[model samples]
Target: MRSSRARALEATINRLLAGGPKFFVKDHRAVSASGDPLRYPARTQRLDYEAEVAVVIGKGGRDIKSDDFTSHVWGYTLFNDWSVRDNVSFGPDFAYSKNFDTSATIGPWIVVNEGIDPQDIPIECRVNGELRQSGNTHSMVHSFAALGEHLSRDTTLWPGDLIASGTPKGTAVDSSRQETDGSFPDTLFVKPGDVVEVSSTLIGTIRNEVVKPTG
Candidate 1:
């Protein structure tokens, strides 16, 4: 799938290709959120991993017909939408903050979109090889088709674009709690030296190491 940054660049290129003036805009920039200029911002500290069924768009258009959405889907890939609990809470409605560089760890591989239905897929997340979160794609409040239709209402949909369904009910924080004074250990926030592994019955597993960015 195409990265958000790539999509924006294509927009400028398209305009210029069509004889329009060259006006450039970029969306994906690396920045920290913790208010420490010295400390790089983490979009999530509790950096949870989600096992999501991702749709790769094959065709690009504005106002894509709802019935035709499936035809435009190129395939499916496993996506770990890395979350920064602290950063997501601060702004951009949890979406943009979560879409940072190296934030989107995708594709051990892609499954063709033709044979399987997207909604029936099962998903789960594990920490250090133990199960922490589990759910079926059927539980999603918004289906892929619906999300695509809604998104196309105002914006163009591009090939390689992604529409990640929101995380399921059992993310790390959902299963943990804080003390009365509101303090939590490194466990409360995923710290370095931890391994986050996520899998689905259909898609298999994707694992990542949790580490601190060096100063």
Candidate 2:
């Protein structure tokens, strides 16, 4: 993974901690689903879509070994780790910025680990049918099994717990790098009425529309 991507993940952790110690796993409350609308909070100016592969824990365990990851796995799904970019800086309030309702979207459904290889799969994200990000699972800095082993070191993973592997390059942050020919405007953040879809060749597609906060 690029340093930028690592920084993004680390920044999220720091934000969640609110100046406390770094932690890996996320609160399950962050999970959402496809076809659901992502409510945009009035406080932030940027809402970004992150295309990720989610690992659903089928079997519970503690201190699980990497070699045993497949045995303990339930299946896989597509996930979108939506973010409020305006709420992030050198130190972010991830708990507040990321834990908002409908922030993490997953599904289209889970694919059991029969003969599938999670390491080499194509992942993509689109806004209103236009491609915004493209990458592969093989490009991930950390493998899914490694993440499970790391998270289970201190905490016990329960059945139904989801572990979202980090996203690849080509997020909204990369909008600035888009072609300057004026053919298409840069996609900086998701706004109300914008439909975002995340798809994987194996797990299928998860789609969500951005909407104004009802609250």
Candidate 3:
């Protein structure tokens, strides 16, 4: 998504010769309760939390037009697109790294889209109560309507299908972060016992505690 830094943004824009927003498939199994434990992946080297705004699909259609994207929207909510920073390149490893259990969180609740401006909502992420990510939807390279238009180019959108648009600038992956001698080793990444909270006034907070697996 264009919500990241220059380095990341350039890559995404260049990924497609047409300069469209990048999109990827997430693990459906990874979705869990807002207050559920973020089970630490056994092999993850850089566990990160990505604060995002997810729009709920109320209407279903195929090849939805850009101008008609709003009719399909039922409401809005918060989503944490928890990511594993190892083997970021798309390939076989990409699946295991991001598809782990409890890797994503939906929301505490949903706020219907009546007077809400989905294009300019504030979003934030906190690790152990410390602010990590702070940004708004205005910076997105692609709007929610555009995403819906492209995503439904040839696919069918169904009711209740949440469209997690994209994340804001500040994430563990962001290079602007000046944390701990400038490194990702263990400073920016979340570890066991860390309480990760992604919140927005439009919806609510989804707090998940990172925990080591017992199995």
lDDT of 2 by residue, 128-172 (tens): 999988888887666778777878888899999888777887777
lDDT of 3 by residue, 39-138 (tens): 9998877888899999999999999988989889999989898888865766666656667898769988888845888798889999999998888888
lDDT scores in order: 0.62, 0.78, 0.82
Give the per-residue lDDT digits (tens) of candidate 1, residues 1-215: 99654686577456534532221111334322211112223444555555666778889877876677888788776666666666344334556546555566556566774487888877787777777778777876667777777677768888877676556756665555556676444364455666766676676666667666674
Order of all candidates by TM-score, from best down to worst?
A: 3, 2, 1
Better of 1 and 3 by lDDT: 3
Candidate 1 segments exceeding 4 Å error: 1-45, 87-96, 182-188
Better TM-score candidate (1, 3)? 3
Model 3 poorest 10 in a row by lDDT: 175-184
- On TM-score, the leading prediction is 3
Whichever of 1 and 2 has more TM-score, that candidate is 2
- Which residues of candidate 3, in runs, are more than 4 Å off? 1-18, 176-184
Score residue 43 of candidate 2 by CA lDDT.
78
